[model samples]
Target: MGAEGKTPRMTSHDAAGRSDDSDHRGYLDGQLLIAMPVMGDPRFERSVIYLCAHSSEGAMGIIVNRPAGSIDFPELLVQLDIIQKADQIKLPENAESMKVLKGGPVETGRGFVLHSSDFFIQDATLKIDEGICLTATVDILKAIAKGAGPKHAILALGYAGWAPGQLETEIQDNGWLHCDADPDLIFGGDVEEKYLRALRKIGIDPGMLSNEAGHA
Candidate 1:
C-alpha cells in the first residue's frame, strides 16, 4: 500500500499465506511455475507461482498474480497496529501502493512478503534469488508500514504447497510449465496480464495452447 493507503486486514476468505526456506534445493527454487490451461484444479487456473523452495520434502511457492481483492496493504498495517489509521497519509508512495496477493492454497490465514533483495532482516528473510526475497515475519511489515522497507514488494496471504515428488509428477502430467523468474513478471502491477505474459515469455501462444495435458 505504499503511497496508496494502509494494508487491509485479511478476512477469513482472504487467508492463504505462509512459507519456509529450503536449502537442500532439489529443483525449482527461484523459478516461475505457470499453470497449464488444463490445470485440473479451478483454484489455480491460469495462476502464476514464484517457487521459493523445492526439494524432496516438497515444494512451496506464492501465487504472484492472484490478488486478495478485498485486502489493501495500507489498511492491513492499520489493522495490525503497525500504524494508526490517521497516520496512513505519512506512508511512502511505494508503501501505500504495494499490493497484497493471494499466495496459494495453503494456510490461508498468515502472511508473507515477497520483495526485492534490497531489504533484509536478520534470520527473518529468505533470499529466493539474487533479485527476489521472501519474509514472513511481522518486523518487515512494521518496516514497510513506517516507509522503510524493500523498494518493491507484494504481500500475500497463504501459499501453494506440494508433497514430495508431487510437483514433479504434475509437471510430467503437464499441469505446469517452468521458466526463469523475471522481476517485471514477478512484481508487475498487471495481475490479469501475468498469465498470458508468462506463457509468451516461454514463447508459447496462450491462445493456441490446448487444455489437454500431453507428454512429448
Candidate 2:
C-alpha cells in the first residue's frame, strides 16, 4: 500500500456532516479503535486505529500504532519526491522523526497524514476535532520536509474502511474496543506500546481481555 501522488484530502463537510446523526448512536469520530484479541481479520490483529470519520454511511480510520516495517520516513520522502536523498540530512528534527505507518487494509497505495490542528491548509485540511486534523495534500509533506509542518504528525500509507453498520456489528461481536484519542498514543514514537495502552485507556488490562467471542 504505497503510492506517490497528490494526497487525498477530506473536506470538512464530508467528514463533519454526519456527526449529529452519529452522535445519537455513539459515533466514534476522532477516537481510538483497538482491535480485540478475537479480531478475526489477521490484517487488523493487535492493531490500533485512529477513527477519522464515522457515520451511519460507514467509517474510516488510520492505523496509528502499526509501523510500515522497513519503511523509514526520510526514505519515503525521497521516494515520493518530497525530498532528495541527498537532502535528507537537512530535514528538521520533527520532520526527520516522523513515523510511517501501515494505516490499514484499504487504499494501501495512497497516503494520509493525521496531524495536530496547529497546521492547516484551506479547503485541504479536515479538522476532525479541537486537537486533530487530517491533511492528505502534498503541501503538508513539503512543509514537514522543511520542518514547517505540524508539531506532531503520523504519515499513514492506506487506511481502514468499513461499510455501513459494519463497525458497530464488529463491536457487538466483541471485535474491537474504542476510547478517546490521546495525542501521545496517536503520534508517539513508540509503536509497540500503543495497542496495550489503548486498551488501558478504557480501563481494560490487556491480559484480562479475552480472545474469544460469545453470544450469551
Candidate 3:
C-alpha cells in the first residue's frame, strides 16, 4: 500500500470487488500469483507474489522482490537489543546476516522467515510445501545468533494474506495469474523478477496479457 492509499482491509472479498467465475481451487499449494498489467491496485502493479499456502480457509504468500533497505542481520540485532561483537560478522551459519526483507504492506512490524526445509523452528514452523517453510518464533533467531540457522533463508518482516474466496475472486477477475510455486522464487534470486518470471513458467509473456481474462 505504501505511497498508495492505506492498505485496504482485506474483507471476505478482495477490495470489495465484484465476484467473478474464475475457479481458484487449482491455485492450492505452491504457486506464484503474478499481477497483470491491468491490476489497478498500486500495491500489486508489477508485483510478483509467491503463494505459500492457498485453500478454502485462506491464502498466504510473500513478496520476494521488495527490499528491506540497507539494514542487515547485525543491524537488526542491534535494533532488537541483541548485542554482538562488532567483529562477529556474517550470519549464524555463514549466511548473510543483514538480509531482512519487506514481506508485505500489512503487519510491517512483524517478521516471517521464509526458508528452505533444512531448518525447522523445533515447534513454531509453518510448512508451506515440501521444500519451503515459514518460521516466526525467536528460537530460530537464537540459532541464527550463533550462526547455526538453515542453509538457505530470506528473513522477511511480514506476509501477504487473503481471506477465503477473496483471492479466488481476484483470479477470476484476471487480477492475478498463477503457476506452480518455486523455492527460488520465494527465497532465492532477484526479488523484483519473481513475478514476471513466474508468468514465464507457464510460457505466458506478461507483456502480452489482456486484462480481460475471457474464458471460452
Superposed Cα RMSD, model 3: 7.4
User: Sort by lDDT, best first: what order?
Assistant: 1, 2, 3
**Candidate 3 local lDDT, residue 189:** 53
Question: How well is each residue in 62-147 modelled by candidate 3, as lDDT tens digits?
Answer: 77777776546665654554446573564454444435676777676666676778887544666666887777765565566767
Residue-wise C-alpha lDDT for candidate 2, range 1-216, written one tens digit per residue: 443442433223222223345244588988888888788898899999889888988999999888787777788778777788999999999887899888887877677889999998876788888999988777788888987899999988889999999999999888887888899999988899988888888887777767677422
RMSD of each: 5.4, 3.5, 7.4
Decide which is better by lDDT, 1 or 3: 1
lDDT of each: 0.82, 0.82, 0.65
The collision pairs in model 3 are: 65-191, 72-98, 73-97, 73-98, 92-147, 93-147
Model 2 residue 87 distance off true place after TM-score fit, in angstroms: 0.7
Best-to-worst ranking by TM-score: 2, 1, 3
How many clashing residue pairs are found in candidate 1?
A: 30
